[model samples]
Target: MNELLVRSGGLYTTVQDTGRFGYYHMGMPPSGAMDVYSAVVANMLVGNPDDAGVLEGTYVGPRLEFTDDRMVAVTGADVPVTVNGESVEPWTAMRVGAGDVLEFAMIRSGCRVYVAVSGGIDVPVYLGSRSTYTLTGIGGHQGRKLVDDETLPLGAAGGRARGGAAVPEALRPALDVPAELRTVVGLCSYRLTEGALASFLGTDWKVTKDADRVGYRLRGGSLDFTEREQPFGAGSDPANVVDLGYPVGSIQVPGGDEPIVLLNDAVTGGGYATIGTVISVDRDRIAQTKTGDAVRFTSVDLDTALAARRDRRERIERVRREIAR
Candidate 1:
């Protein structure tokens, strides 16, 4: 039961696990790590379970001091991580002794970074998750991002870990600009004119400053709805429909101009018409994209979405096998 002392809590650092699931119907969004792949891979590197809680950092990373010897790994963003100011490689497991300082440099690319220790963050689990939903202050350290001088508890490590455990080059995600996101087009897409739906797939949308764990609002795309009188109870706005459940990763155009892709901590349901959903696997890709990054959506069928899921699972299995080597 060692502790992790926070030296400088970098920009928006919070504890996250796989996610809080099955609570969306009550308007509680799953608050979890945005880049699921990176988070899981990081835990794997440290020989922890896939759902172990890790630190999620945006733009900057927190500086931490370990209270005891532990294994650690950094993943997601290609940022420089240092041990007591000495450079270390990322995407690989390393050992930290008691009183060792871990710090991160500015993000070189990508947005979120995951710091996984051998023992997961030991915050009391609520609703079966240790993830922090900061909007409502539900889980994690006070349901908020870490602050300077904060101390985080660590769970007991389930197994041993060796330093230098690495995820091979090919297995890493491409955080390339103009990330192409696979979307399953259906939902309430019927409300949009054929030309408008085409415009959505055809345009390269830019992530706006409004992007966050809740949702990503994109600019550079406008959708025109087919002419129709407002339905009973639906709002007068053309973008509005009967308030319905918004699937995680669902896309909605509020003003018919800015299209928002809901993410991990997004609201559960709203009156806005949802065009489609970014396939679950592609959500990992979108998570890495920062404000100002270019994004394009490509329509995919249910089968394609399923195939992508299988591919991701297989890749993860491969990483597990590699770590065992």
Candidate 2:
């Protein structure tokens, strides 16, 4: 029964849930929290369900004023949080009430942050999710990022979290390091010469400013394509393949140069020749990296990818248990 008044919307804050599913065939991307691990942990701190809607802040954090009492937590980045100008810790549940203003200082590390309140953000669901797909204006708080003075409604509180509930140090994510993404290379990788594939893994790519919800563009050493005639339906560009469904987290190099990592909000199908896919768990790692950061992709097998998926689930369970203690 509380309202969150957006005093400031920071850089690009959006309401996100687990994500929209089962619609990629129609070209709809699942627009959700880019850093699923951070989003889920933030919710865990506040006793919200893993898929509950939370605010995803990019770089800068939003300034919000609570209109009623609620429990809140911030996660993902090493940013300073405050209530009524008083410093509060991230990864810990804190109580807030009417007139209490939550603000963020400069981002010390990490690119995005997740904010979870007692009650999830109660935006109207679109396609079975409360995620915001800003490109086409669907779902979330009016299908866009929060702006100054916009009030967000909250549902019934889901947790009995009390103040001082802190996430264990080992359970929290860290930000100040080179980001590494585990990738499964194969689809259309034949387009790249053997040396190019090696270079792709050996190089440390720099994230470009053009990176956004849709996908991340990286600049590194050029990758060379193997000589071959274009396929029947494939485009003329060496990097082009027949238009096909892009698996979430797939990476495609255009002109055998910069690689693009498709994310949650990216087009489901494209003509680009995807050379690999970052494993599900490492998507969380790359999500924390901002423009100008160094990223290295390590090749892994499907077995390794599956193991990583399990490891991520186990880690989340660990957080849940620690919070329940």
Candidate 3:
């Protein structure tokens, strides 16, 4: 087996892939990379499978030394990176000599950075994924974040095909957040007061610092449905009771009259009233939002949402072709 040693593991470095699925019923949160699109892009750049295990780095990246020559790609947040002391850019495939050292600094734009190897990190998978879920100790590198002195498995390296990998110049994801995040009205929408639905759809909210793997808490105008109006009003939606199944993008209103948008590591079930769910297409924006960023939820008809998703997929495909060329 080839070796990839962590000489100096940085802050919050962990092994992640797409995520563990089909186990939420067993009370396992699908812990994975926060910016899944970026992660997949980096993996693809290195010619790895879309779900290959990669490194999810936050704020800083580890000091790593390779045991053999290999091709690698790093993407996601703009974390200053260097080989030995020289600089490197994100979204570019690079060759690392056996003794070369790679380092990453503080975050400049977003919070997470993804590093993907040509053949992907050679780690045993659990529940069909190699993502690290620190909360429950389930998948990924020992089911916890990587730390100093940790050794990771490097994929087979003898005479493997090597090539440069890079993101297409014209098809890079926009760093700017979109104006409105599309949502599908939920079953519990009726529980909220008449204005609650409209207020959530039209007004703006800011992302609070109180966000983490579980969920993002939003701060905005109070959405009062009153204690009396809620119990039976919005029935069977995400928020109506505790322990009901929840999907990733579920927006549930708790007692504070504010909604919390569930993310990648959100719980499988909860006791709250869900007003709406942000569609899968707009989840990337929610993943990159920083504290104090303004976000507005907009309701869109099913057709518009489907069309938007199609456009995004087409754009990504075009970019892939360009990069391949």
> Of the candidates numbered 2 and 3, which has the greater TM-score value?
2
> What does candidate 1's lDDT look like per residue over 15-79, in tens digits?
99999998878899998999999999999999899998999999989999998879999999889
Per-residue alpha-carbon lDDT of model 3 for 14-93, expressed as tens digits? 88888888888887878877777788777767767778889987666788887777777778776788888899867887
Candidate whose lDDT is highest = 1
TM-scores for candidates 1 onward, in order: 0.98, 0.98, 0.88
Worst 10 residues of 3 by lDDT: 229-238
Question: In candidate 3, how many Å is residue 114 off?
Answer: 0.8
- Output the worst ten-in-a-row residue range by lDDT, candidate 2: 171-180
By the lDDT metric, which is better: model 1 or model 3?
Answer: 1
Stretches of candidate 1 above 4 Å error?
Answer: none
- In order, the Cα lDDT scores of the candidates are 0.93, 0.90, 0.75
Model 3 stretches with alpha carbons more than 4 Å out: 158-163, 177-179, 226-243
Q: What is the lDDT of residue 25 in candidate 2?
A: 87
How are the candidates ranked when ordered by TM-score, highest leading?
1, 2, 3
The model with the greater lDDT, 2 or 3, is 2
